[model samples]
Every structure is written in structure tokens, then in C-alpha cells.
Target chain A: MTDIQININNKTYPTATQPSIANLKLSLNSNEFICLVGPSGCGKTTLLNIIAGLDNDYDGEILVGQQHTHPKIGYIFQNPRLLPWRTVRENIELVLGEHQSPDVIDALLEVMQLTQAQQVYPERLSLGMSRRVSIIRAFAIDPEVLLMDEPFVSLDAPTARQVRELLVKLWQQRPHTVLFVTHDLREAIALADRLIFLSASPMQAVSEIIVPIARSDRGNELAIESFRQQLLQNHPEIKQLL
Target chain B: MINLKRFLSTLSLLVFLGIWQGVAVYLNSNTLPTPEAVAKVFWLGCVSGQLPFHLGVTLLRLVVSFSVAMLLGCAIGIVLGRNKKLDAFFDNWLVIFLNIPALVTIILCYVWFGLVESAAILAVVINKLPNVIVTIREGTRALDQDLLDMARCYHFGKRKTLIHVIWPQLHPFVMGATRSGLALIWKIILVVELLGRSNGMGYQLHLFFQLFDVASILAYTVAFVAVIQLIELLILKPLDKKALRWRR
Candidate 1:
């Protein structure tokens, strides 16, 4: 069965003169990692918001899973939206709820290397540390689908690389359907099973390129570079975004 | 730095007292009593237990009225701030209440309630309630919609959302309301007591006014002001520190 199905016929912002997105349709298999690449302000975040049910102002429907129930959605926003008043542990626990086991929380904290920082408040954390906490928060619920909106956009290169590697490792441990959004083609090539390219504003999928290499193999710099070259050669318009 | 701050504060108070003494000596009138005379009366009041008794009565009225105003004001403010329909409906009403003089409200309550204790307390509450509502409503309106969206995405139910997400963001506003409420309510209580009730610092002040006893009046004012300052230092300051510790 399809893990998720999204069919947004149209979405328009009241302030904008034009519809932001229309005729946007896609389906994903369970555990598939799909990266959406688009120019800035192309309604990629809007699409993600629609799928996550954070927005419902659009036309058409988004159905998750065979039963069409509201699937457990974990969203990692561009900025770590951690409550400044809450400690890192409390922020994670907020999502985990009372029923989740302490062991599960401990494991997530350990994996994120946040065990020591758990007691500290978000304001005390550096940007990278806060982002890691946000990732840990997303994973704590063991969600069926994870939606990330430019989760590493503003980080320093080294920190971004490390976080991406950590994200891949975490995903491998217990795979879930991921809809990762980024403007970075190389990052998309490295993480996604399929790269979905979106048009400029009022976005819809222009094309989709399935990465032939394995997720583990895509991490190799030379391999991803070659893939990036091939993608630019075939779809020259994508180079404009870089 | 801390020592310097303390020294400067003490120095300023001494300077103020010195000026007062100099003025009293120059005036040489019973109406403007000397600092020594006021101090003597203050000591006598403390010894006679009358000062503490009236001060306690005033403090009780302040507490009851302030609590009621804060609780109800916060609830109403949040509701109005969150709902456009309700806010529009009551926006004019809030303005009307806010503009209505505190003295008018106190007098009306006394007349309507026939000089009862509840009337005094209610008068203070009514006087203070609008300010609390205004402050909290502004806070509620300024709440981060992004955080609220995050809460909704996580499926935090109403109770969890209120406690964990909503309340923390609203803490500063609540504190703002509380501080202002304390300042405003205490003054209103004094007025209410003076106008109606035969007890509390206000009543004592009224009696002193009839006898033209400036020294006792100044003593009562000093004692009450000291207690209010003590409450601020002992209770509000510590709570403000703890609540905003994350800011550090």
C-alpha cells in the first residue's frame, strides 16, 4: 500500500495575486526518502505544510496510509522551534507524551549526542545543538512519516555535513517515509531515493529523477558529484537555483 | 557593584530625610511635623499594635481583591485576545471600563452594596480588573503563532497545550499584570476602606485627617509603604527571577 498520497488541486494565498501551487500530486511508498528541490518561494514549504496537516486551506485531499487515518507526522521546521522556556529534555518529552517509555527517550538523546545538553534550556544551546534537539524531538514520537523543511539551511558547512550524516544514520536504523525539502542539489542527491524537482512559484513537480545509487553509496563525494553533473546536463534549468 | 547599589540607595534615603528635617525646622509648624515626631508616632503605633492591625486589614483587602482581579482578568483577556468576535464585541466595553475613574467605581460599589466588606473588595477588583485585562490581552495577542502551530502539529491536546505551550509564553505577561494589579489594587483598597469601612490603613488615615494629625498620618504612610516594598522585594522579585531564569 502507498504510505502517503497527496493531491492538491490548488492553493492560493490571500495576499498573493497568483495561486501559489496547483495540480500538485504525488505518492510515496513506505520508507521511501523523497527530496523536493525548488527555487526559493516556490511553495515547497506550503506543500509540506499541507501534507503535515498544518495547513488545510488548499483544495483536494491528502491521504496517509491504507486506512486514510491521520498518520503520526513529525515535522522538523527550518528553525528549531523549541520552546525557549522548556529544557531540551522537556521539549522532547512534550512530544513523547506520558505513555512513551523512558528507555526510548534515552536512546534518542544518546543518538543525537544530546544526553548532556538535555537539562539545558534551548536559549543556552548553540544553533547546531538546537537543531539536533529539534531532530531528536521529531524522532522521539517514532512517527510514521517525517517532514523536514530545509532543516540545515543556515548551518555552517561542517555542522550541516555532520547533521546530514547523523540524519542518514538515524533513518537507516528505523526507516520511515521522509519528505525532505532543500535547494541544495548535492544534499538532495546524497539523502533522497528519488529527487523531485519543483518549478518556480505556483509550484508543481516539473520532473523526478530516481537516484540509481544506494543511500550508503550516495554519501561518497565523487559519486554524488557525478550524479549532480548528470542531473545538470539533463535538466539545465536546475543550475539557475545554485 | 551590588554594595555600591545598596550604598547609593541608603544614601539617597538619608538625603531625602535630611531635606525633610531641614524643611520642617524652617517651617516650624505642627502641620508639617518634624521627622523625629513622625518617627515617635510610628514607634508608638507599633507598640500599641494599632499600626499592624490596620496595616494587616488593608493587606487582606489588597490580597483578596488583587487575586480575584488577576484570575478573572487573565481568563477574560485570553478569551478576548484569542477570539476576534469576542474581542470586537468587548473592545468598546473594555475601553469604557478602563476610562471610568477608580474613585467613581469605588463610590458606586459602596453606595450599591451599602458599605459592606465585599463592596470594598469588589470596588478594588473592579478598579484594577481593566488594567490586568488590557495587559494580558496584549500578551495573548502577541503570542507566537508558530509555537502554537508546532503544538497543533504535535497533537498536544487542550490541557497540555495550555500548560506546556501556552502558559510559559504568557508568564511574562501574567507577571506584568500581577505587578501592575498589586500597585493599583492596594491604592483602590485604601480609598474603599476610607470611604466605607471603619478599619484598615485608609480608615486610620481618615481619622487622622479629621484631627489634623500630620505626624501620625506620615507614620502610617511610611509603615504601609515599607510593607509594600517588603512584599515586592520578598515575593515578586524572587518569583520574577525564577520565572525568567531561562533568559540568563
Candidate 2:
């Protein structure tokens, strides 16, 4: 993996209309699975959007590596955003572009654990299934950076745990630079190599913690619980949610 | 063997024809000739190639006018759908055009361009264009904004985005517009041909009306209506099903 560092320099917004992440500065490096954890309205999603180049209203220089090549980011949105008119496979292939093979399709479906539902339309799939499709679509492109904003926010508890484990496994396979944004401390602790905790709205990075657990330990509730408890004491807001 | 439902429907149609024949027999005049006599006149017109000639003329006009109008409408619709500023500028014009009486437009075209085939064709195009544009433009408006952003993030080129993203989303809208436009254009073309053109099914139907030949009039109407239904069922329906295959 090539070493890429993103620098957000003095990114500020007007007090009246600004989202959080105003005047926030952070740099992410190669092979970093960084999670941004914060309260709602903390501009976690806004930051992800800006980094993905979907939002350009910020005041900062976003650099990838040493140069300014517009970073190729795979963004898995909060909602699946699958075209209602496309089947599950076709929706995933939309990101893979045309000229994909049947093998690639079967592999992605298998990875996402959606092999049986490839031919099904988006409306027929459950919310969890649709979100899983969206994740695999993002990963299929093998983007330089993966930017996911609360990608599993809508799933039920057991389903969310399954998806969280799937995400960690996929992240391990590729080891691409990841900037995952979510409010769940357990989720952050489970998946992130490094966790960036942010304050309330008009947010700034309050603390940065490196997760010391092995990638294989992601789904172990006891190990994840220990880490969650540590994070809860440091960030009182996270404790309130727990 | 005919199904009972179909036979009953056929019987109703025959009863309606009998009432027409009875009325004509009671009048016993050239202005209200009997159905059998009108049927014979219609048969003679068909065999003598008069009806075919008129049908060919009307079909040629429909093909030329509908093709040009749909092409132009789809182009404008896609453009206006992609660009909000363009949609805002032309939306009012489309609304006014859809609201206008097709006959008034035909008369205006006749006066402006003279009593020519071009004038009649232009009238039919004008009547159909607004519906196509409105339907397609609305489809474009409902486009997935996030998918577009994903395409941008992936550096998908203009051609790729159109083929993969925009075209798939906008297809149903384009088809809906085309069907609605075709349905409107068929009737409007008849009026345009009757008032402005010197030949075509509509002109012949006008001739039959003047001579009070109801069977020939009905015969021409049935033939053209059947053609429209055939085009829709055989051509448009198949195309629609192929394009919407992803729909359950």
C-alpha cells in the first residue's frame, strides 16, 4: 500500500450556518483504519462528505500522500442508495463499471454473504441486505481510500454485529486507508485501528486512541467491551449513549 | 371456437350496426345511406386502392412527424432534466404548449406555412412535443443524487455516467412520454390532415362525411386505431419490458 496522508488545514465555517468539523485538523496515513466517533450533529458525516469531495463548502487543503491527486474514495452512504430499478448484482456492478465478469460478481456476492440474492431487486431485499450490497459495491472498486458514514446505522442489533464483523474482515483483506464515521463507541472499538473522538457540534478532535486488539478479535464481545469501557471513561458523551 | 365473452361483445357490436342500418333504411336518402350500401362503397374504395393510398399518406406523415418530434423532445428533455436552469426557463413554455388546442395549432400552422403537408406534420409535432418533454424532465428530476456523486468520486466520464447511471433511470420516463405522446399524436394527426393536407386517411374520412358514408368513415377509423394498438402492443410493449427487466 502506498503511503497517503490527508491534511485538513484550518478548516473553518461560519458560526451561524456551519456544520461541525469547523476548524478541525487531522492527518490520516497509509493502512490506517481510523474511526471518527462523536454525538449526532457532530459533522461526522459532513467531514466524510468533504473528504470524499461530495461536499466542497469547507475552507481547507485536502491532500492525499504528498501530492494533491484527487483521492479516489469509496463512500458507503448511510442509506444504501441502490437504484430501485436495478437488481442487487446490477446495483453493485454500477460501481465496478461495465466489463465486469461473472466470477467477480459471484466473489463479491459471496464476500457480502449475498450470493443467493444477487438477482433480487432492491425493494425485495431487506434494509440489512441492501446495506450489505452497498458495502460490497464500494469495496469492489478497490478505492485508494474507503469513507463510510454510519454505514450500518439502520440495522437491528444482531444484524449490525454481523455487518460490523464483515466490515473488519473486508478491511483486513484489503488494508486500504479507511475513514469510518459513526456514533457507536462499540462499533469504533471493534473495527478501528485508530479512533478519533470528536466534541459536540462545531466539533473538533478531542482525543485520538490507538486500538491495540488484533483484527481477529473484532467480534469478541468481552474484548470489545473492555475497550468500550475505557473509551467511555475518556469520552463522557460516549458513556451517555452506552 | 369463440369464447362466450368475446361472442357477446361481438353480438353487441353487430346490434349497434343493425341500429345504424335501420335508421338509414327509414331515412332512405343519400345523406343517410344504408350500412350495406356504405359497406359496398368502403369495399370498392379499398379494392380500387383509394383507401390504401390515403392510409399510406397518413402513415408516412405520422412516421415523419412523430419521429422528428420524439427525437427533438427527448434531446430537450434530457438537457433540461440535467440542468435546472434550462428546466426553469422552458417549463412554462411546455405547460402552455400542452394546454393549447391541437386544432388551433393546426389552423395556425396552415395559415403560417400555407396549406401543405409540412404544415400538417408540424401541427402534429407541436401537439406531441410538450408531453414527451414534461414526462422525461420529471424522470430526470427524480434521479439519484448520491449515485451521481459516487460516479463523480470514481471519476466516471460523461459517456459512462450517461450509459450506466442517467440512461437507466430516465428510460421509463422516456417510454411513458412516448406512449402518451403517440396516443395524442394519432388523434391530432387526423385533425391536422383533415384541415390542412390534401391527402391522407383524415382527408378521405372528411370526404366520406360530406357524402354521408358512415361505414367508410368507421372502416378508416377502425383500420388506423388497429394500427396504433398493434404498434403499442407489438413494438412499444416489448421494448418497455426489455428496458424494465430489472423491475419485479
Candidate 3:
């Protein structure tokens, strides 16, 4: 894995009232957990869309690793976004393609605690369960770059925490460059190796701070909050962006 | 609960048959034959192979025209739905076709193409295609973009994306078209047959009507209605079950 370099001069959406993204430059290091923290409606999702090659209308360049092209991408949208017709196992298996059997999915489903829901369709799943399936689907493909857009935003507390732990565990096992976008600073501090704060419309990175806490101690909620407090005190410039 | 529903259904059908028989006996005329007279005619027609032959011919026409219309409509609908400029250009044409009467199209196809089998089939398909296109076009417009994005990010190829992501979203609309199309196309096919074709249920019905054989006409009608009812039971119900299995 290598760093993902994103350089955008201007991105004006035809439908948007304001400029979408302008003069945004970001570097996500190889196999590292990078979180982008910004206020809601700040065009973070649009940026992720551009990086994932869903919206190519933007005037920008996204380099996955060293190559100026999309590598395999695993994206988790803000909502669960699972296909309602497909069962949980089938949803993950779909990404594996035709040649590969679903044998690999068994272990991952076990890890995500979704083995029981393998045959259950998305409609029957709880939001939390559906989110886990989405996570599993992304991980199933073994993507080179993973992009997540506020995946844990609306879930209940315990469920979100559990999914976060599951995501960290998955990343620990198969390390890849992750560009996680969210407005929750505490959540970002809890998960990131480095946190990048972004400004409002025409999004540009305002501040970049390396999380001081070790990955080993990130599970401690109190420690994460204290570290966030200390980091905010040291750098008051990002407070406004947050 | 299922058994109770079945019992009620049987009772209603029996009551209907009894009322029809009672009316026929009260009238005591060949114009309004008893249920038994119609039943004998139906059995004789079946045994003599005339009813089966005409029914089979009509069914073949229904299948061919329905398949062609649905395939053409769905393809055109997707194209119109995805391309805004093309849709704008073609919107007036679709509106014109939608408003054109089925009888007019059948008559025109017969007049222009002559009383050939292809002309008859073409007429049914022409009458049915616009409705399917409009229904499927609306469905395509309403598709969830988030799911589409998910499909794109995962690199589901065009074929996989169409089958897994696109088709399920369009299934309800397609089903709507299919049921309505089946209802409509068969009626148009019968008219096509009555106007020009030498065989099929419509031709047979015309022959019965000319002879003033009410029993034979009712027999043929009963056979056609039974086939439709059978189609509802055997084909549509199971397909509906499969499509909606994902729902709660």
C-alpha cells in the first residue's frame, strides 16, 4: 500500500447552490487510518464520490497509492444501503465476483457476528445489522483503498461502538489506506491515526493533526476524550472548522 | 385458515353455477342454454380437438406478442430514462402511441401489411408496447441513486449491476406491465384474429356467433376464461411469491 494523493483545483456542481469543492489537497498515508472531520453538508461525501470514481465531473486528480487511477474501492455510505432483495451473505458474496465461491465470507461473517443473518434479506435486518453487512461487503472484496462517509452517524451508541471496534479489528488484520469522513470529532479521535479537519463549502483541509494516542489504547473512551481535549487546547485554529 | 378460504371460494363458485342453471331452466330456450348443455358442448369440443387447437393457436400468439412487446418496451424505456435529451425528443412520439386506440392500430396493421400472421402479431405488440415503456420509464426514473453508487464503487460490471441492482428495483414495475399487458395483448390478439385470421379462439367464436349457437359460444368463452384463471394460479402467483420473498 502507498499514499493516496488528492488534488482538486475546483469542483462546481451544477445542482449545488454554492461551490462544492475548491483548492482541496489531501494526502492519506499508506495503510494508515485517516479521518476527515468536517461539519455536515461540507461536501465530504462529494469528495469521497470523486475519489471512488462515481462522479467524474469534478476537475481533480486522485492517486491511489502512486498510480493516478482508481484501485479497488470499498465504500460504506452514510446509510446501510444494502440491496433489499439480496440476503446478507449474498450481498457480500456479490462483490467477490462470479469465479470466487462464498467460502471466504463464512469467516468474515463470523467476525462481524452476522453468520446467523446469512440468509436474511436486508429488509428484515436491524439498522445495526444492516450496517455490519455493509461493512462486511466492503471488506469482502479486499479493496486496496477503503472510503467511508459517516457510516456510524445515526446508529445507537453501543451498536456504533461495536461496529467501530469491528472495523478497527478488520483493518488491523488486513491493513489498507482508509479515508474515513465524519463530523464527530470524538469518533474521529477514537479511530484515526491522523485527523484532518475540513472547512465548509468549497471544502479545503483546514488543519491536519496526528493523533497522539497509540492504536493499542484507542479503545478507552475516557483516554480518547482527554487526548481530544489536550489536542484542541494546543491547536485552537481547528476549533472553528470543527 | 387456508382451508376455510378454499371452502368459501368453492361455495361461491357453486352458487354462481346454480343461479345460471336456474335461469336457463326458467327461460327454457336454446338462446339461453342450461349449464348442462354448455358443459356437454365444452366436453365434445375438447374431445373433438377443435377447442384445444383454437386455444393453442391463441395462446401461441399471446406468448409471442407479449414477449416481443415487453422486451422492446423495456429496452426503449431504459434508453429513454437514462438519456434526458433523447427522452425529450421521443416524449411526444410516446404520447401519440399511448393515445392511439388498439382497434385503430390493428385495423391499420391489417390494412397496411395484409391479413398475414406477422401483421396480426405486430398489431398486438404495437398496442401493448407504449404502456410497458411508460411504466418502466417511471420506475427507472425513481431508482435509488445510493444503491447505484454502491454498485459502481464495488465494480459490479454492467451485466451484474443490471441484474442485481437495476432489475430488482424495476421488478414491481415490470410485474405491473406484465399483468396489464397480458390482460390487454390477448384481447387485441383476439380482435386481430376476428378481423382477418382464419383460426384461433376469435375465429371460432365468430363461427359460433354466425350460427347463433349460444351454447358453443359460452363453451368457448368458458374454456378461455378457465385458461386465464389457470394462468393466474399457476404462473402469476408463484412468480409473485418469488419476487416478494424478500419482503416481511
C-alpha root-mean-square deviation, each candidate: 1.5, 3.6, 1.8
TM-score of each: 0.97, 0.87, 0.96
lDDT for residue B59 in candidate 3, whole number 0-100: 96
Best by lDDT: 3
Using DockQ as the measure, the top candidate is 3
Which residues of candidate 2, in runs, are more than 4 Å off?
A: A1-16, A97-103, A235-242, B1-43
Q: Calculate DockQ per candidate and list them.
A: 0.80, 0.51, 0.86
Q: Pick the winner on lDDT between candidates 1 and 2.
A: 1
**Residue-level lDDT tens digits of model 2 in B1-248:** 46998999889989988998899888887666676776686688789998879888888888888898888988888899899888888888988998999888999999999998778888888888888888877888898898788778766778978888898888878787777777777788888878877888888889988987777887787678778889898999999888887765
lDDT score of residue B133 within candidate 3: 95
Q: What share of the true interface contacts does candidate 3 keep?
A: 0.88
Model 3 stretches astray by more than 4 angstroms: A15-17, A98-101
Docking class of 1: medium
Worst 10 residues of 2 chain A by lDDT: A2-11
**Candidate 2 vs candidate 3, TM-score winner:** 3
Residues B99-180, model 1: lDDT tens digits = 9999999889888888999988888888888888888899889988989989999999889988888788888899888877
User: By descending TM-score, how would the candidates be arranged?
Assistant: 1, 3, 2
lDDT string for model 2 (A120-154, tens) is 98888888888888888888887878888898887
